[model samples]
Target: MPENPVDPPGLDLARLRAHLDRELPGTVQGPLDAELIEGGRSNLTYVLTDGTGRWVLRRPPLGHVLATAHDMGREHRVMTALGGTGVPVPGTLLLDPGTETLGAPWYLMDFVPGTAHRDAAPLAGLGAPRVHAIGERLVDTLAALHRIDPAAVGLADFGRPDGYLERQLRRWSTQLAASRSRELPGVDRLHGLLAARLPESPVPALVHGDYRLDNVLVDEHDAVAAVLDWEMSTLGDPLTDVGLLVMYTELAGVGGGIIPSAATAPGFPSAGELVARYAGLTGREAADLDWYVAFASFKLAVVAEGIHYRFRQGSTLGAGFERAGEIAPVLAEHGLTTLKER
Candidate 1:
């Protein structure tokens, strides 16, 4: 749990207690031990415990968020939708979309206990086989998700099919313009190049907007216990998801990053291997994936920088924001480099 968790304003303690009483009943013997978990600035997460100390409860931040961006309902929806689908997700227990209860929307799920990493040591602990297994599982899981019909799952209204890439470029462009602390020359150039080279994407599927090793929790045996962070998830180009993962792979090598390979620990999958693994699962060639991959880098750069922006504004805590800002330049360089190579 991060120190000084940000509790959304208007959190309804009494309602939460009542809801828990109805849902968990006797399990919560006394006052629920609720502590806000840091690192989830986009959403508010709390580690809830019973008198005996068992953890549960994850929720979005209090206050209004972008309708298309931070909808907790969507987060809960995807988690609930993935139930029994081979994707390991924290078991969703309850969803409270109405603000009448917690002053904002929130959900309860089984707390998955495990190790998560950003710097390399934890990744090394997971070992090579498990890492590779995660790689395979990532592809297979996306394929399985893409295979599902959104209409069947009551998610037909999730995203628009047409102009996804275009809309995304414009959206992020706006975000950068709005929040950037200082101008980076490459930002505009990369944006222009991506706009010009927009390849036709396959029909939209559910894409986890931020798919990275850090967002996943691996159990002791080195298997992914849960795929956390679906705040950016939506029905979008499947290649975008692949592109994000690959970009993470590339950047991981330069810093404390995780590689998805069971044969080797803590090194990125060879470009050929990553594409092959994905293609094998989806029968979709990753040709011309450079644009999306670069876009992923750029998007992340802005997002990471946004952390710095927030911290400076006193919206978040921890010195991680400084390191996060550094990723912007690295990501921009990687995006441009990939563009040139492609």
Candidate 2:
């Protein structure tokens, strides 16, 4: 691991060491080394190791605060609550909600060993059978999540379930307004269409705000080892989670074209198969999925536009952000076309 003695852009090693020492007692020993984990577009993540001990830390992005966007405590609380269930979240060791520790709220969790398949290339050599199984596991795991009772798991107060679809449309629209670097073509039209076609959500369940192959970790046995990136997890329409998963599965290039993914791996489950599987497992109605997919596209558009806004303001942390703005228009166009077909 590369060592930067100075405080890195998102993490202050000295301060972090002090807090870990104060809060965790003897969890960390010797000097602390922190490495910023790239590829996260929203909250900042870092890997910390003190010679023998290792853990992962999550905090908000450096600048351009968006209300309810990079919430550290919300993410931590959801993970902590879900631990008692079948969900495979990292074990929470500490949560520093106040800024007195390292100038921002952060949480430390046990970094379990698994691979987050970000793109298709990583699973290429695993052959079609394993890739197909990976896709099946992804959908099944989502079904598992949707089956959990939020109240039973102590997450009933996470978010309001009534009028979730309506509130989501308004919420993303507000996010767009907050990050409006420039007028995005078709965004407003897409939002209006989504609002005009809000579907009756099934019984509210625990929804992983961003549900995709990359957001999960797959182990050597081709099973989903852990579900990650709970920054957006909340109580809402479960179909929205399926809709987002459907958007990411690329079967023979027929699905989402925004980014190449393990979903495109040979023999990976088709969007239809994933939808059917989730429906079969959880027995939840999937009829209103088209509207949900369109909504997912709208949500992604606003999220991309926000990243673009931060990039323009020089607030983003990693590379490839220069092209983040380019995805919003494409997503919006897809959203419009998706709704038109229904």
lDDT of 1 by residue, 1-342 (tens): 334333334355567878778876875676655766654546667777654656656555333333455577888888888777667778887887777777667788888887555555555566666666666655666666667777777778888868999999998888876667886758788888999999998877777888766677767665677888888888888888888888876666453222222223454355557768878877777768999899998898777666656656665543344456666777788898999998
Indicate the worst ten consecutive residues by lDDT in candidate 2: 250-259
Model number with the top lDDT: 2
- After superposition, which runs of candidate 1 have C-alpha atoms over 4 Å from their true positions? 1-15, 22-27, 38-41, 53-55, 60-67, 98-103, 253-264
Q: What does candidate 2's lDDT look like per residue over 200-302, in tens digits?
A: 8888899999998878889999888889899888889999988887766622233243354677777788899998888889888698788888888889889
- CA RMSD for every model? 3.9, 2.0
TM-score of each: 0.84, 0.96
Which residue pairs come into collision in candidate 2? none
Clashing pairs in 1: 44-61, 128-262, 129-262, 132-261, 132-262
